[model samples]
Target: MANVIDTLFSASISRHVICVFLFISLVYTQNTVVFQPPFVTATGPTVTAFLLGNTSDVSLSLRTVSPSNTTGSIGSPSCTDEATRWVLTKEQIGKTAVRIKLRLNQSLHFCGENETSTNCCTKLLCVLEALQVTACVGNTPKASLLVQATINARLFPASAGNDNKTVIPNQVYQPLGPCPCDLTVRVCDIRCCCDKDCASEDLKLFASHCLPGPFGGQVSPDPDYQCSVQTSKNSPDWFPFLCVTSPPENNPYLGLFYHGSTITPKSGPSFQRQIVSAPLPVNMYVQGSPIITLNNQYFSIPQRVLGRCVNGAPVAFLENFQVECVTLLRSCPTGSPLQTLPADLSLKVMSGQGGNVVVHVTDKVVTDLNSFISKNNALSSAAQKLLCENVTLALDYKFFWQGNGITAVTLTRTIGTLISNVSVSLTTRYSAVFLNGNITAEPNSGNPGYQVGKPVIAGTMDNESESIQRAFISIWNPVGDGLCSTAEKKVVLFGKNSTSGCLLPVGQQTPPQCNLLRETVTNLQASLITSTYVAKRGNPDLLNLTDWMNISFVTLNSSTAMEDTASTCSGIPSHQHILVWSLVTGLVEGVPQREIRDLQIRYTLSTWAQDCGGGNSLCEDIQLFPITSSVTFIDIPVITEPPKARFQINFTEYDCNRNDVCWPELAFPITRYYTGEPYSQSLAKGMILVFCFITASILGTPWRQIRQVWHSIAL
Candidate 1:
């Protein structure tokens, strides 16, 4: 009886402690206060409550209900009836709070007042544990009120499967909890020896590659600390076991439970700053900075999205872009001009400084569908009937900036018909030029000396008129495999001398029809300049010795003209070579002036050798070869025999300023060395004179002493 009393006393003390803890939690927890409304009353199987907040619309959703604890004896009636355990209804009270009414069915029973309940309240057998009420207001932050009730005891212990907290997996697949390799059920996973479904045979085959146990299963003793030993090991024979290939798990992030500073992620910037209000701090613009615009709205560039025009794409600063989009036109205008589409609207240039916005330039798109049709003569006259066509081909933009911001902008629109219904083979180009806060001029090929990649200054000079005119030379450019008929002409760039060729057709006509081809070739060669004189600065200045010079042609061979066979196609030159000689003249303001000294063209006339297939009968199918031309530039100067050098010695008398003849203290020779000799050779000769004086002193003194000794011996 004394032991029973001690047990009862312990039970009473435990109940009292739990009641005190519950009261403390009710007063301290801020999140729980949102759920405990001012009034809650229960009648029979129904519950009614009034929630807080009158401005928002409140709605309730069931989250969780506590499980019932019933120890059933053998053969006892089973717990049944689903309809009796139903719950329902919620409504908003007029401008005061929300009213929630719940009706419980008869299948759920209330606990006895004196009984110790499990998984629910002592007074109630089945009770709500968690409920989420969402309150929403128009254009306001949504509020979520979460209500969770605490009980003295629960039927089931909390496990990973029952836990409400979410876990985000790492990028690399690693075993979490107990079964990382148990990814499939009722089937043996490949190379997964740890899978329970796998038989002994399957594990034997997987032994070569599969790891012994769960990957990354070892836990660090200290939650706040980590080391390399915790990293997951990789199987040598197998690739990423269950995830995309990743490096070793050296990342410091130790799951959400690790102790560290909580970091909330933020989104990237959606819009750029306006130019008018932006301060002038830096000269160059960064990648995401706003483009300078006249209006307060954001500046947008026309872009192509999936082959169609997407007009309002935000333009990034300091980015070069090009886009081509297909635009649909309803019809070619007959009486009235077609209205401009939003994509065809112009962009205005805004000054990148000051408080007030200023417009500096504006551009317009020029659409001439008629001109486009006329240019392509192959187009049918029914172009007007096919009015619903894709016409806009490309849009080009060039932005000019001066340190602080963009100062000018130019737009060029190229309108043309599309080859297909959906797309066009065109692009919009963008370029930015920094002027350093000044107007920029066109760049020159070279200031004085020629730049390496810059085009050579080449033109034709008239001998009779003494004038020069600029001209460009072109060569035959074969489209595919050097076919003659399909070849196009392309201009040659200076310094980039290259050879190209195309086959020429030969026809057997009465007066040798190839003569027309020969005449055309001669006319092109006639305009080439053989010799010319050029000035350094402007026109030739005769008085300036280094101002002007004459450049002429020189040939390697004695022959000046190509050899030709009369009345035959063989006379046509098969190959022609243009050789240019140039040299650096003088440097003007740190720029080298590379001047052309000589130029010559050598021609190799073809010879006809026929192998007759019809036994010496007039060879009908003669194999004619292609004509080729090549240009070569040599950076070598002309060579000439230098004049002989002469030497003269000059002697000046000391004090000669007052007297007619006074002996000088020093005199030197006036001499000139050969062009290739080193200037240090004169100093070497002076050193030789000093060596002679030292040698004479050593020999002459010894000879005088020997002679004196000889005289003494004779005496």
Candidate 2:
């Protein structure tokens, strides 16, 4: 019995030693060995430009600098260099590309800390930070020069189970995903207490709350490890025999334990270069991928989903589209009809330092709808007060992007009068503008000529005639009363003809007041015709006839006579018209290039006192009828004299043969006459030919006589 007990104890000790050995081996394999791949430079030269002073292409490169005399492999002691980086003197990020410049022969440095240190630090790797340039003088090419380089070291720590390589989500606390319940822009979702977008005051009024699982779906319940009441069948095999009892907090598996979870799954190559087709070669967006900024954050734009505005909606890459969303404004229940503009929390913008910045700015408390209109207008003070409204009717956004990400955005808002207790729908428009270089001016309608549906570039010429002062051809915008009291300038789009007018209310029409009103309307008409030249391209110095078109202004007197000379006056401004003439220069890639020319602004004056009764004479409370402004684009080509024939034997329709017809319409064999021929002569020739053919056939003439008759008929 003593020998058996000793043998069993020895067997248990052996098993314990074997299990300990396996656990140590697994830890050593995963934590100790750090495998790192070799680094490579980008395929092409970084930036190349043709210097005006030099004939050859001057190029630059970006490269990294390694430690001096380093010989050992990565993660080895001999190759260890913790501080490694390349710094640029200046960096400019444009719409679709980034331009970074470094001084010639700049010093490289190693200053950054290495978080992936295995022994104090991980081994230093190669770096790509350099702008290499080759100078060319006239026809002579110079040797390549390395301008600068950056030193690169390991960035991640050597760890077990591939924990350093796994993708850890940023918003780990929001287990249900970001804003699953927050549907409206700033309004609180119903019964969604977890929604952070809800106001503190608003959330207090909820009748009930929703119950959520632990960690809001982030953690799953593991009944086996949890210390809870359990049935005998579901418990350990000991089943009350040798069972141990402990508090919930003191449970062994209760704190940070994983049973069946795969903390680190098998991973593939970390970096991949995917090739995708795009309109431009520099575009970096892939199909179906979310649009991202340079810092790898998702690029979000304002989107309308299910009739409500969702500000942080992620935009897909390579999507050139426009979406209109209804933006709901909070209405104050008791106070002023206007509510405070809600803060825009969805847009994400970055500055030069690569940090998020707020793009929306609050300038004025109230936006005047009639601010663009002349302050000295004839409309009464009461009528003018009605023009200013605190409502934002339209939002126009222009996004400028490069191949990598969006670089800049422009926002323009149109304000209109907001009425109390009335439902108003806000319209938001989006547009994507392509930028080649650092451009500040508005994008041209077309490159070399004008394109249909684009805003025409109409502006006055500068003193130097080198550039144009841009002025828009706009119509008056209307409001709730359908009056022309809009402050926004609605630009006249090319190929679109529009005529809009509004009633001008008159309070008192004395002689001096009537003259002032006439001047006010006349001045408005003159201001509308502000520009003298229209251009096809952004730059008018191109000197091409199709590039610049002249604009002429003319005034016409109304032909209508006054009803009574004493009571009715005839000085009222009636109509204003802008006649735009455009001709199709040519077709480029199936798109017509319209060369706009001969822009004319015509103003006509008519009688205004006719609206008031002739007996009244005072015209005290009369309102002038609609004062109109119309824009018409004539696309028909102008008629010009036909070109003179260079050689004799003119290609007139009169000298045409049956085989070689001069005119297309008379080319068919059944046609009796050619174009431009005398009708009597053609009829007489046809009769003679028919008579001769019939007589020849009746007399049984030979085929040769018939052929001779055909020739005589031609004569």
Candidate 3:
């Protein structure tokens, strides 16, 4: 117990020096002073230094100091000593003891290796001759470092050219940041797999340095940095995605990896490939003509033409004069023959009637004068006794008859007589009858002038020479005997006796000379009684006066009773009995006046005497005679012709899809959507479930725990 074990070794060396000063103050307040040669003076210094040893014994030294004006000159330098000789050098690697490693390619330097003097082999051969120098001259060598000790510190960004200067191992050196407000860490991607695979890819994988997140970790093998390679979501299916951020001085991990995927980009496909390459097609043509031209009438009969088609083809129009074919030949099929004409001819005549006759004859005996005694009893009694004994009648008579009846007869007569002279006086004797007469005193020679016995009046003493005597009686009379008399006493008379001769004066002796011969027979019987001789003897028996007293007593008793009866009946009277009794009484009286003159004849006659004897007649002696001969008729007139035909038309062109090859349907469908802003707020629905649960919890962690907590961060 050597003094009580010296108090237990002085209390265990003071509790082991208070547990080694509380483990060095808890590693100097949470082990964050890792500065292995880390140095950064303002902006430039020939050494950005750092080296915490392990990776093999720490030996990273970079030192550059120029800029001096006779202050502490090394190799005479100015111009601010090549602008403070930008520099960098780093080395800090430790595996257990709370791990820590960072070897920034040994560190950096310049300023001609600080005017060398074999200063660590001229600053490690001037950083290995600036890594085999390909091209680098000015300004890009700026340097910075602030690594303290214990652990947690990084500032990697070196490899520039010559095939990798080294610093990759899960790279991420995020630095540059300011310009344009840290423009995504000043246009990030400093190589090293474009800063850890395009910093979580997307944002069009940092699109060829149009930068933002392929930050400074310096590991460029290019292939656009293959961090397990994955980029192409088909390039966002075709363009458009941009995100850029960062600032307050740098590494905001490229503004948190491209600000949430470029605030919603993706969307492309060239507007649906330009709407399927621009579109167009649909057609029709038809101009005019399915046949037309009428009047010259080719109506082409189809019921009278009407067909149609317009925008396709085929058309016609003519109707009714005869030729129809309406609407694609409206079911045509009835005897077919489609039109024509010509044929009709004619002419005519016919007639009747033929009867009639008349003839009239008239004579009426022959007008007047007892019609020539009834046409002279038709004449031939030896022509009426040579026209009544040579035609001599007194008072100028005239009669005529010729042809057809009396055949011919004519008579005419005229005769004359008158004579006388007588005078005798007692105081003056006068006696006449000179040439054939007697003045009986020449013998009475005694004179009454000679004296006479007074009363004895010897007048018979014959001569009495009386101085007055005259005689002028030359009478030879035959006043009227122009006999046309049928009777009128067939006159028998004679008396021209100068005292006795040519006499037939009969009987009674004179006594005053028989009273002057009975006063000359009473004045010749009163001048032969005339009624125009009894109208020319128109027989009233000729107006007889006892036949004029029997013709004056038969010529004075035929010489005094035949000389005194010829001795008293002279032998008993026989003289052929008086001429046979007058020839039998004139043959029985001429057979009863010739049978009454042939019954008053009317024998008809008309010898065309020049056509009834008038002037200017011709034209076949115009008696015109046609009273009636013949004519008769009834209805009439006729002529005729017409009938013949044939004609055609058939045109067709129809097809609205009757298996006739498509094309004809468009009547109204075409609608397309999605343009940006997070797919248009993810197609609306209140931020699409809170941005799809924060992007599926950031891809469900474990990406090496966010790259070891972002490479133990201490920029």
Candidate 4:
């Protein structure tokens, strides 16, 4: 293969069939043939450029490429308008001898001026259809190629190849295992529920979109998207479980599967499509109306984001056209075709917070160039933002599952997949459930991306049953890898063998010796997962999830440390103090399952006796906080006020009974009221000294007589 190569459909002279038996020779459709066409491999910093040319009175078409030595797919008429690229197959790696049968299949004749005409030079020569190549960095030991391409931009010539082999000129290329990563703009790592941490019972996640698209599939607009929300999963029946799954490779986009139950993809509901005026923003990844969530489960009307050029700058603009939003969430029996929206419970639509976003949409997807020019007048700078021409398709699908016991759950998100924006998260109604544990994710060798499912009791396991032992969940990556870093190809784990207790350095403590541990990813994917930096959109440092996470846990009277006292949090601060510690717990919520004994302290708020104002106040003193707050953990605000003061009886000094009145009437103080501030005995002593001085000078003796007596005594 030569370097600096370009496809030349030249028309300078006569044509001859040059069948050079160099690497391969094969016949495609009887009408097309492929000579060992010259190809340029990458040389140093420069890569091979396929140049599709146009000449006078001649047109060439590349019919097909039948590889004799390797297996791959080659687009037809690849040498048209612009240079085309090739996507190599995984099977082609490591073979030294490679050849292909290049053929020219179809050509439509075009009218040109006569040979003697003056405008003959303007005759079109060749067209390079959207096809190109990918550059491969040959790795001797591993069959995977480090591929790079330029499909999103124009400054470079292109080629195609799968994880197989192919290269594009001028595109940023870095290998994560065998995958080629590209991020022209930026990715949205939207923080949904977990802030700094999601251990508090008050956590929420929300999403909204107009021109939403389906995951692993194309974008469309039709049926509108909507959702029904239950702010309280306290009933447990409201905690929805999801079974996110995929069929065979024939249907990569169909992941009607998840943690709660097992269902066939065909059994899933079909999406409804319609024509509407106000479409959602384009480029939706997940689509669900009335998103339902619980432990290890989540549902959302996901959509993708499409971008366009504005005044020469590329800006993400939702498809300008209307869309058919899929009804992904199932509606109650009270629903009909016109009433598919969630009927039972609706979210309060908390604007600008907790998963809710305010998006400004415009009609930008104009697939029709003529319509774009005609509709968008000279004033509309968005004319350049043509995303789609016609109406967008609605992603209408419903989710359903029947099970028992509060099922421990899992939501598997594919890491190290093609698209980075595909995300997954879980949320419950305000105060519905408290979460604390660890998150586990890793690649599934039998599958593509890593798994995001939780192991919970389902079917006969009623999700609310005590059988569900609260364990590891939504915590930070146990390995301490960054969000996107561990996300590429890794599995997060949580619970019983909770790492929260382990303090030893990694690899230092033997497995079983630490009680809790983490699993290992395969060699190839591990290479990328072990990196300290989060390589997203080529910016490895894009996100740092070190302190910020949505996974945590809480427990009452919880203890993993041996020396820990039962009164660790239940005892009063001091005998003189009025407060009694009733209990202590670990943060129990989503996936933060660490149990450090040293870090354990008196978790005073959760554990306490009846509200005895201060240390001795009666039960009636305890009450809810009188003030209301706008800030909240989902539906509930900070609350449950303790008594203003407490009291206690003291009889250590003397008789505690006189007339049988055991209270304050007794000789010794029976009951002592305790206000937070203390009275000062030192202040009383200072006051007495000042009073004595006043008495001596003004009341004890006349000023002149006292002075004479004092002088005589001194003489």
User: Which one is best on TM-score?
Assistant: 2
Quote the lDDT for 141 in model 3. Answer: 20
> What TM-score would you give candidate 1 relative to the actual structure?
0.30
lDDT tens digits, residue span 361-461, model 4:
12212122221121212323432332211222122221111010011222211111111111211110110111122112111111111111322110111
Off by over 4 Å in 4: 1-715
Q: Where does candidate 1 have its weakest 10-residue lDDT segment?
A: 72-81
Candidate 3 residue-wise lDDT at 472: 16
Candidate 4 local accuracy as lDDT?
0.22
Q: Can you write out model 2's per-residue Cα lDDT over 1-715, one digit (the tens) per residue? A: 3233223222321122212222333434443211010111222222212112121232323333323335421121222112323333322222211223332222223234744433231334343443333233333333232322234443444443642232324222222133333322223343445656444443453424432332121233434544355576678776566544554434332223222222454445547533433322223333235654444565565665444466556666434455665434333122211222435423555422222323343222223433322223233344322222555434444544322334455555454454323222334444433331122435556533466677867776665334566767876554445544543346888888898776665554444355656776776666566777777442233333444667787777645653435334566666888888887754432345566657888888776554444555645575645668889999876567676675534545454563364554454333644545766776677788889989977777587789899999999
**Is 1 or 3 the stronger prediction by TM-score?**
1
Worst ten in a row by lDDT for model 3: 344-353
TM-score against native, each model: 0.30, 0.41, 0.10, 0.17
For candidate 1, lDDT tens digit of each residue in 1-715?
3233223222321122212222333433432213333212232344544444443443444333222335221121122212324364666545444555555433333344675544233443344343333343432323443333222322443443733232534434332234334333234444445656554543454355553322312332332223322335633333334334333453333222212223454544547533344333332344346564545455666654344455656565544556544333334423211223333345453444332222232333333343333122233454433433333434455554432345455555444433322211233333232222122322224433445565443444554323453333456666555666666655554467888877655544334545576664544433333325433222122333343344444323335454433434445555667766667755432344565556556666554344346554665553445767777878875456675454312333344555465444123212332223454775576578889998898789788899899999999
Q: lDDT of each structure?
A: 0.43, 0.45, 0.21, 0.22
Q: Select the stronger candidate by lDDT from 2 and 3.
A: 2
Model 2 TM-score, all chains together:
0.41
